[model samples]
Structures are given as C-alpha cells and as structure tokens.
Target: MRRKILLLDTGREWGGGTNSMLELLKRIDRQKFAVTCCFYNNYSRGNSETIESILNSIGIPVIFIPQRRQPMWAKLSKELLRTLFFFNRSLKKEMIARVDEIWRVLPNAKAISSIMRAGQYNALYMNNQPSTNVEGYCAVNNLDVALIQHCRIEPQLNAALVKRVNERVDAVIAVSHGVNQSLRQSGVDAQRCFTVSNAIDIHQTLPDRAEVRERLGYAPETFIFGSIGSLITRKANHHIFQALGQFKRAHPEAKWKMVVVGSGPEQEKLAQLAGTEMIESHIVFTGFQNNPLDYLAAFDVFILASRSEGLPRVVLEAMLVKTAVIGSNVVGTAELINHNETGLIFEYGDIDRLSGYLMTLWQDATLRQRLIEAAELRVREQYAIENYVSGVEMILEKCIERRTHV
Candidate 1:
C-alpha cells in the first residue's frame, strides 16, 4: 500500500519555502506515497491564484482549515493586557505570544488532529520550522502518525518548545547542513535529523531577458542589480540599499539601478532608506511578481543579504538562470557560493565589503560570467529536482519503516 502522508503548512502568505514545497509535491513519487495537503490559510493576495487553486490544477487534494474569527471580548481582553503591560516590552511581547497560543494555536491543534484522524494518515509532514508548526507537533502527540518536520530556516525555539519537539517529532528534515547543525544545538537527536538541500527545475522556460527588461522599463545597457524575497528585516534589504549608496558614491560615473522584487512589512522603511541614501531614483520596487523568474533572468547580478536562510531557493533559481549571485555568508548560501568561484560572499552587515563586491561584479564582465558559468554548472549537476525528491522519499520511507517496527 502507498504510505499515506498529510502535509501541513501554516503560513498566511506564500514564500520561497512554499514555492519549494510545491515543487516537491508536484514531483514526489506518487505511486509510492499518497499525499494530502492541509493549509491554515488560502494565501490570498489580491487577484493571485490561491494555494488551493494551484494544487487543484495539478490533481492534488487540498484542505483548508476553516478561518475562525475571534470574539470581540477576546480582542478587547488582548488590548487591555497590552495596555496593562505597556511599560515592559519583553513581558508584553511574551504575554501576547502566550495569549495567541491559547486563543489561536491550541484550537488549531485540535482541528489538525481531527483532520489527521479522519484521513487515517500514516505520517504527518510539516512544511516549515518546528516553532511555527507547534500545532502540528501537538496534533500528533497521542496519534499513531509518524511526525516529520521540514525545517526551512534556523528555528527560533525556546527550551520548552525544543523539549516538546524532541519528545513528539519522529524525524526532522533540515534544508541545509547549517540548519541540521542548528537542530542538533536545539537538542534534536542527530539520528532523527536529515539535511536535504532545496532544488529547482533547471529546464523550466523563462521569458526572454530583453523583453522582460523592456517591459520593466529598463534599457538593454542598464546595469541592473536585483534582489528577490520578502522585504523583511531578516532579509536585510536595507543593507543592500546601504551598499548600493556607498558603491554609487565611490563610482559616480557608473550607470546602475537596483531592482527589489517582493513585498513585506519593511517596504516603507526600505523606501525611506533609499531616499535618504539618494538612490531613490536608481531603485525600483516591483511589489510582488507571480513570475519572479522573468525578473531573475533580466538581472545582471542577483543579491541576497539575508541574516539567515534554510538553503535559499532563490539563490538556486538565480544560479540556474545564469545570474551571477552575491549573498550573505549565512548557512544555506555559503554551501552554494564558494567565495570567488561559484559566486561572491559577504559577511552579514558588512556594507563596505558588500559594496566592493557589487562594484567588482559590475565592473568586471569576465568575472561575472565566470561566476555564473560555475554557478549554473554546479546547480545543474547537484541541485536537480529529481535528486531532491529522491532524498525526501528515502527519508519518508525510513520514517514509515520505523513506525511499523515501533
């Protein structure tokens, strides 16, 4: 019989992790494993296709948890608590998080448990970090389903949460070795942790670079530097702005522009920083594009200045598209970009060094071409979608086998 697996995702917005998960689901071995996906939200953004619609198009079953509206009294109580603890920020934040856990997460856990039981799933596959999927771990506590967590980021877990994960989760899949090391530091058993680097479909077609650049109002000769991902503090896009500002001041004769693709809470702050840096006219913010690959292909260089990552899928996509990459020396990124070979790496928050590398790539076409060539070859040889799927399949089979023995 096919090993039945229920995949759960709790994100309200679609992200790189979700994109990677969709890729995996589309190509996973269907004859060996029957998979059902359950999402906490529809991930609706304006007129974009929802996650449910996308999955339905591919013949995969999707279940959405009914959105529960909090009562007015509950909202008022939370506000009152915030007002009462206004003086102590840490206490206030902790209190709010606890209240959210009680009012939101625990109820969701009950709902998740019901879905697991009704479906008679043999394994529960969580598509995010352990901290976010606390309910997934909780839902499988007393059930027979083997629990598996796909940690896509360096998790932020407190001692209590770490204990809960170690006690309940059957296995954990880290997207990179750095992430696997993080799991070990958080007290997750080494035997139960596996590192499966994220991958992409290398053969996917992309829009012509010239056409994409024209549509975005960029001239063919424009030296475009691009970054794609949520505009969050963790992504550290402001650092990119700082680096660009410094680079521009040093090389006033160079004609260049920075294109930031994707939207998040930090958009306003980033815009203000751009204006302050006097590069506002040289920067373009394409809020959120459904087909970022076109933009990726159009870029002369791709930059990722994230504080952390779970093997950034964007870097892999950038490499696959033959775009030269400059990324922060974080776990997942370091594995992909060898200092001067596949791509350049900068220490996180080092604006001066980042500016120098950006200048180097912009000035030296030969060096940029060499990096992209090596990056593309590396991605094609090692990070294919087939290899990623097989690795996860092997892990799933082992989880099921262990469950049977237990």
Candidate 2:
C-alpha cells in the first residue's frame, strides 16, 4: 500500500519554499507515496491564482484550514491575565502559555488531528521550520503517524519549542547544511537532522534574454543588476539599492539599471530609499512575476542581499540562466557562492564591499563569463531535481518504516 502523507504548510504567501514544495510534489512517485497538501490559508493575492488552484491543476488534493478569529471572552481574559501577571515573570509566562494553548495551539492541533484521522494519513510532513509548524507536531503527539519536518530555513526556537521538537518530531530534512547546523544549535537532536540541499530542473526552458530585455524596455547594451524575492526586511533589498547608489555616485558615467522582482510589505519603503539615493529613475520594481526566470535570463548580473536563508532557489535559478551572481555572506548564499570562483560574496551589511564587487563584475566580461559557466555546471551536476526528490522519498520511507517497527 502506498504511504499516505499529508504535507502541511502554514504559510500565507508564495515564496521559494512554496515553489520548492511544488517541484517536489510534481515529481514525487505517486505509486509509492500518496500525498495530500493541507495549508492554513489559500495563499490568495489580488487576482492571482490561489495555491489550491495550482495544486489542483497538478492533481494534488488540497485542504485549507481557515483561520478563525479569537472570541471576545478569550481576548479579554488574555488582557486580564497579562495585567494580573505584570509583576511576576513566571506567572506571566504561565499565563501566556495558557492563553496560547486555549486560543491557538489546541484548536489548530485538534483540527489537524481530525484531518489526519479522516484521511488515514501514515505520516505528517511539515513543509516549514519547527517553530512555524508547532500545530503539526502537536497533532502527531501519541499518534501512530510519523512526523517529518522539511526545515527550509534556519530556525529560531525558544527552550519550550526546542523541547517540543526534540520530543515529537521524528525527522528533519534541512534544505542546507547551514539549516541543519542551526537546528542542532537550537537543541534539535543531531541524530534527527539531515541535510538535503535544494535542487532545480536543469532542462527547463527559459525565455530569450534579448526578447525579455526588449519587452522590459531595456537596451541590449545596457547593464542590468537584478534582485528577485519578497520585498521584505529580511531580504535586505534596500542594501541592493544602497550599493547601486554608491556605485553610481563614484562612477557617474556607468550606465546601469536595477530590476527588483517580487512584491512585499517593504515595496514602498524600498522605493522611497531609491528616491532618496537619487537613483529612482534607474530602478524598476517589477512586482511579483509568475515566471521570474525570464527576468533572470535578461539580467547581466543577479544579486541577493538577504540576511539569512534556508537555500535560496532564486540564486540557483540565476545560475542556471547564466547570470553572474553576487550575494551576502550568509548560510545558504555562502554555500552556493565561492568568492572569486563560482560567484562573488560580500559581508552581509557592507555596502562598500558590495559596491566594489559590483564594479569588479561590471568591468570584467571574462570574469563574468567564467563565474557564470562554473555556477551553471555546478548546479546542473550537484543540484538536479531528480536527486532532490529521490533523497526526500528515501527519508519519508525511512520515517514510515521506523514508525511501523516501533
């Protein structure tokens, strides 16, 4: 019998993790493992097709657990508890835990447990970090089903949360070694952690670079620096603008443009920063493209200034499209880039160093070609979609086998 696995994601937005999940779901062996997706939200945004629709298109069943508002009594009680516990730290902690359990965790766990029981799912697979999937772990407690967390980012966990994970989660499939290390540091058992780097399809077709540039109103000769991902604080997109502004001021004769793809809460603030830097005219905020690969292909260079990552799929996509990449020296980005080799790297917040790397790539066509070639070959060889899916399949199978034996 095929192992019935329920993939649970609590995210309300579309991101690299969602894309990676889609890739895995599309290629997973249906005969060996039957999978159903359960999300907390539909991930709907202005006229964009919901994640439900996308999953249905690929023949995957989707279930949404709509978020319910807290009752007025619960809210008032929480406030009262807070006020009463103001002078006692331990009492405040207990009060908060009680409120959280009554208002959030218990209800969510009950709902998820019902779904698991109704579907007869053999395993619970969380598509995010432990901190975000507390309800998933809770749902599997004292149950026969195995629990696996596909930890896609470096996790931040408190003592209570760490204890909960160590006791409940059977396995954690980290997207990068950095993430695995983070889990270990956060008190997740070392034996339960596994690193399976993110991967992509090497054979996917991309739009013509020249055509894409033309469509986006850029001259063939004009140098373009591109950054793609959510316009959020963690992504540090404003740093890209800062570096660009610094570069432009030093070399006023340089002809370049910045293309930021994807939208988030930080859009207006980033735009304002660009204007303040006096490079507003040189920037294009192409908010949320469904196929950012086309833009990736058209770019002369791809840059990421994220403060942290699980494993950035965009960096891999940029590499696949032959765009020379420059990224901050963080976990996933550092793993993918080798300074002066595959691509360039800079200190996370060093605007001057970022600007210098940009100038180096800008002036040297040979270095750009070399880095692009190396990165593409590396991704194609080591990060194939087939290897990625097979690795995950093996882990899921193992989790099931262990649970059955126990």
Candidate 3:
C-alpha cells in the first residue's frame, strides 16, 4: 500500500521550495506514495496558473487554509525586521523571531493543526522553513506521524523555532549541503541532516530556444544572458543590472542583452536603476514564469549573483539546457560551481568582477563551450531527476520506518 503523505508550505505565493514540491509531486511514484498538499489561501496571491492548480490538475487534492493575507503594511514591517536580521545575523533576532512566532505563527499553527489532525496522512512534510514549518511541527506533535523537513533555504527563523523543529522533526532533508550546514549551525543535529541537491525532470521537453527568442523579438544571433530569481535583497538580483551597466560602458557596440525572469519587491527600484544607467533596452524582466526553464535555451550564459541561496534549481535547469553558468561563491552555489570547472564563480557584490566574467564568457566561444559542456555533464551525472526521486523515496521510507520503530 502507498504511504500517505501530507505536505505543507509556508507561503501563499509560490517560491523555489513550493516549486520543488510541485516537481516532487509530479515525479514521485504513486504506487509507493500518495501526497496531499495544504497551503494558506489568505496569504497566497491567487493566480489561474499556480502550484495549487497544477497539483489539482495532477490529481492531488489541495486543502486551502483560508489565512488572511498579512496586510501590505504588516508585510513590509515584517520584511524590515527580517532585513535587519539579514544585515546582522545576531542573537537578538531570536527574541524578535520568538515574538513573531508567539503572536503570529503559533496561532496559524493551531488553526492548521486542527485541519491536519483530521486528515488521513501517515507523515507530514514541511515544504519550507518559513511559516508553515512551525505549523507542520506543531500539527504533527504527539500525532504518531513522521515529520520530515525538506529545508531548501538557510536558517532565517528564531532559535526557539529551530529548537522546536529540531526536537519535533524526525528527518531533515537539505536541498544543498550549504543549507544542511546552516541548519546544523542553528542547532539541527548532524545525524538528522542529509543533502539532496535539487534536480529537474531531464526528459521533459522545453520550448525551442530559437523560437522563444524570436517570439520575444530577440535578434537570432545576439548573445543573451539571463537569471531567474526574486528581485529581493538576499537574491542580489540588482547586482546583475549593475554588472550589465558596466558591461555596456566597456563594450557599447556588443550585441548582448540580459533577461531577469522573476518578480519581487525590488522591481521598481531596479527598473529605475536601469533607466539611470541608460541600459533599459539591454534588460528585460519577464514576470513570474510558469516554466522559466523552458526558455533557458535562449540564454548563452546563465548567472546567479545571490548573496545567499539553497541549491538554486534554475542553475540546474540552465545546466540541463546546456547554458554556460556563473554563480556567486556562496555555500549552495559554490557546492555546484568548481571555480571555472563546472562554471565560473564571482564575489557576492563585485559588479566589476562579475562584468569581467560575463565579458570573458561572451568573448570566447571555446571557453563558453567548455564550461557549458562541463556543467551539463556534472548535472547529468550527479543531479538527474530520477536519482533525486530515488533519494527522496528512500528518505520517505526511512521516515516511515523510524515512525514504526518509535
């Protein structure tokens, strides 16, 4: 009989961890596993094309906990607090976080736990580390169900929450080794942590790159570069624009452009910066792609300039499509880029250095091909979707086994 699993996500809107859940739901063997997903509708930005809709189409019943979306003022206020946490990873953030949890998160957890307790699931999977994680942990406590935390990002929560998660969760699945390390630093036991790099459905077909570029009105022969991420401070997507501004000043006649393939809070400021730099025509922001990887083939070089990351799925997708890659030397990114072997690496905020790397990749076809081929080979060999599914399958079984023994 298939083991029934209940999956929960923190955000109403979709992000990498939600996308990862979609990927897993699409590929997991139904004969061995059955999944039902739960998300907060109150906080979610409802769209026709969404992870919830996609899951529903695939026969997974989605349960929406009607959460009132936090008002814009409250959201911004929380982000301000988080920004302070980001700039200074201090101990006091724990107190602030504990307050957030006590007032905001625990109430939501109690609400969700009521719905979850009535469900017929054998295990609970926390799809993210933010809001729903606490809910999942609280929901599954004393329920005799397996609690598996599939952490895709670093520790951004309070120490109290981490301690609670550490005590409650039976297994910790880290998307990258960097995320695994971050969890440990935040008090997760090393024995509970396992690294499972994000993978793509390699066999899935994508839109033809040439066709996509033509449809978007790009000149066929122009060299194009792109990155897919949120326009947030942590992503440092603004740096890509700054680097491109430098690239344009150095090579004004070059027939190259950039594509930013996600939307976030910093779009307005980034757009204004583009206008100021006179490179507005050199950049395109395609908001919220349903299958952004389909257009990966359109990029000659794909880069991520994030100050922080959890094994970027887009990096793997870019490699799968054979786009030459560049990443910042952060934990998740550095684990994949072997310093000019798999792909190039750059310092987090060095626009000039990033601009130089971009120029080098654009200028030399030999080097570009070398990096692309190596990246593609590495992904195919180590990070195929089938292997990832198998790894997850094993983890699920282990969690079940642990529950039985307990």
Candidate 4:
C-alpha cells in the first residue's frame, strides 16, 4: 500500500519556508503517500495558526505536541539566567544535561507515540533545520520511520543543535544549491542532501499588468519599482530607499514610484529614514498583503536587498510575473538572476552600485524590455509548479520504494 509520512516542524511562525512547504504539500500525491503534521504549540504564533487552518481546510491532520508547549526547566532557567544573557545566555550545564532536557521536554516522543498508535506512517518528514523537537523521538523511539529533514535557512545560531539533528535524520533537503553547499561545509552527509529550488504558483503570481496597475493606482506611464518581504535588517530595504532617493535626486522629474510591501520590526525606522528623503512620497509601504502578486504585477522592476537567503519565493514570483529584477548578488540570488540577461545583480550592501543600476533600468526602456522578455521565458521553462511537484514526488517515491524493500 501507500507509504505514510509524518511531517514535523518546531518553528511556530510560517515564513517563506512554510510557504514552500505548503506549496509542496498541496502537490504531493495523496494516493501514494499519506501525510500528517506534528508541531509545537509553545512556540505558536498567529502565522502558525493560520498555516494550521490552511492545512486543515485541505484535510490534513495536524498533531499538536503539548509537552513542547511547556518546557518547565527552560521556563525556570530563563528566569534564572535573565541577568547573564541580558536575553542571550543559556545554562553552563554539561552536554548530556542540555541534550537530555531538550530530549525530555520536546514533543517528539509524543509525536512518535502518536504515529505508532495510529499505525500508518512508514516515514517521517521534518521540515526546516536542526530541530531537536523530533530528534529524541526518532532516534530512541521504537518506530523505525525513515526520517527526512528539509533544511530551509542558512543556519546562523544553532550549529551544534542542527549537527545533532542532522546526525539522526535519514535524508536532508536543501532548498537551493547554495544552501546545499553550506550544509556540506557544516558536515551534513553529502549522500543525503538534495537541492530543491523554490517554485512559484504562476496562477497566483502571473497577473495581468494593466489590471494590477489599475488596482494599485499606477498611471500607465508610471515606472513602478517594487520589493516584497519583511521590513527587517536582513532585507536591507533601507538601502533600497537610499538608492532610490539618490536616483530620484539625479533624475528630478522621473515617473518612478516604489511600493515597499510587507511589514516587520523595522517598519517605523525605515519610514522615518524614507521620510527624510525627497522620494519619500515615491515609496509606499503597503504592509503585508495576502495578495502580493497584484503589487508585483504593477512593477516594472523588482528588487531584493537581503544580506542572506535560502532562495526567496519573491524573486521567483517576480520573474514569473515578467517583472525585470535587480537583487543583491547574495547566495541564492546568483542562481536566479544572470546579470544582464534575466535581471541585474549587484554586490550585497552596495548602495551606490545598486542606485546606478536602478537608474539605468529606469532610463533605458530597451534594457528593461530585454530583461523582462528573457525572464518571462526562463521562468516559464525552469520554475513551473509541475516541475516542483514532480521532483518532490520522485523523492517521496524513493522513500516508498525503500520502505517496500524493507
């Protein structure tokens, strides 16, 4: 029969990775693989709740791990070490004690038991990285579910924890070649790691330009520039504002206006900085829109200024919408943009160079037209939903075939 899979995620909020997971989950063949989700409630946020609602609506059963919701020692220790960390410090305990506490408290045990009790799953799929939340259960528990880890981010803080988790999981999924390269450097087994680039929902993203422009109040002549993502330091949007400000000063009568969509902790600060510039009115912060593609459709150029990334969905979406893009030549971006062909790429955090490129794209209609045409063709051929679904299905099938052999 069908090989069953249980998905585990300890992260409480739904970010780009979760969005990718949702997209991949929707495409998995139900007849070949039964899917279930296990998550931690203690770290729960509105985004996680929203994701759960979406999954349930699609008839996916989400198993909430209550023990993970309340880690008694971690709660007590946080109060005890409040002065030491100043919000950063952790215990000076031995590795055994720390790993033990982590193992005891996380709901991985409960999750495994639930899976065993239900008596269905032959494999476990854990999304995102270095989650000790499921490691304890998978490593020691009786059920021999083939474990899979989907590594989504460029791990910064939890190297040791991620190392332990990687040691236990059967397979690892890196979202892009860049991420896979880093995972190899971090000692993740090369044989187990798979690079699966993020894909786009063309129907949701590839909107009619005229209609989207009309909805966003953009004039037919307006050269709209856009960026979508959180207003955080990693995004480096302030630099975009600064670059655009310089460009506006250079061309005082340009018809360009930028729409900064999505909100985060950096909103007020970025707003204050943007207000100090001549192009403040030119930059509109739409906060977070559920339908961001409508905004993408209105854009002549799309930009990303992130310092780090595992393959952003926005770039794929922008390319799919036929919007010419300019992004920082950071990790995953290099794989997507080809300098002058599909789009332009600049050195990460280089505002002057970025400003120059933005100016060139704004002034040169031929270059903009060329990049847009190439990008549309490339996205249609390389990043379709069918390709994404098929790749994931092949992996799931491999897991199933292995299970059958056993």
Best by lDDT: 2
- TM-score, per-candidate, Cα-based: 0.93, 0.94, 0.89, 0.85
lDDT tens digits, residue span 318-388, model 4: 88777889999887888889999999999998999999999999888899889988987887787877777
Best by TM-score: 2
The lDDT per prediction is: 0.89, 0.90, 0.80, 0.75
Model 2: per-residue Cα lDDT over 1-406, one tens digit each: 8999999998868889999999999999999999999998888644588899989999999998888888787788878888988998777866777777778878898999999999999999999888778889888886899999999988877788889888878899999999999899888899999999999999988778888889988997789999988889999998888999999998899889999888899999998999999999899988888878999999999999999998899999999999999999998989999888889999999999999998999999999999999999999999889988999999999999899899
C-alpha RMSD (angstroms) for model 4: 3.9
Clashing pairs in 4: 85-89
Candidate 1 lDDT, 306-402, residue by residue in tens: 9999899999988888899999999899989998999999999999999999999999999999999999999999998888889999999888888
Q: What lDDT does candidate 1 reach at residue 354?
A: 98
Residue 109 of model 3: what lDDT? 78
* Model 3 stretches astray by more than 4 angstroms: 42-47, 69-92, 130-132
For residue 94, model 3's alpha carbon misses the true position, in angstroms, by 4.0
For candidate 1, the per-residue lDDT at 351 reads 97
Which tens-of-lDDT digit does each residue in 1-406 have in candidate 3?
A: 8888888776745677766777788888999888888777523332456666687789998887765645566556666777767767564465456666665677777876676677767788888763346767776666888888887876676566677776878788998888888888877778888888888777777678778788878897789989887778888877888888888999998998788888889999999999988899988888767668666888989989988888888888888888889899897888888888889999899888999998999899999888888988888888888877788889998898789799
Residue pairs with backbone atoms closer than 3 Å in model 3 (clashes): 12-44, 42-67, 42-69
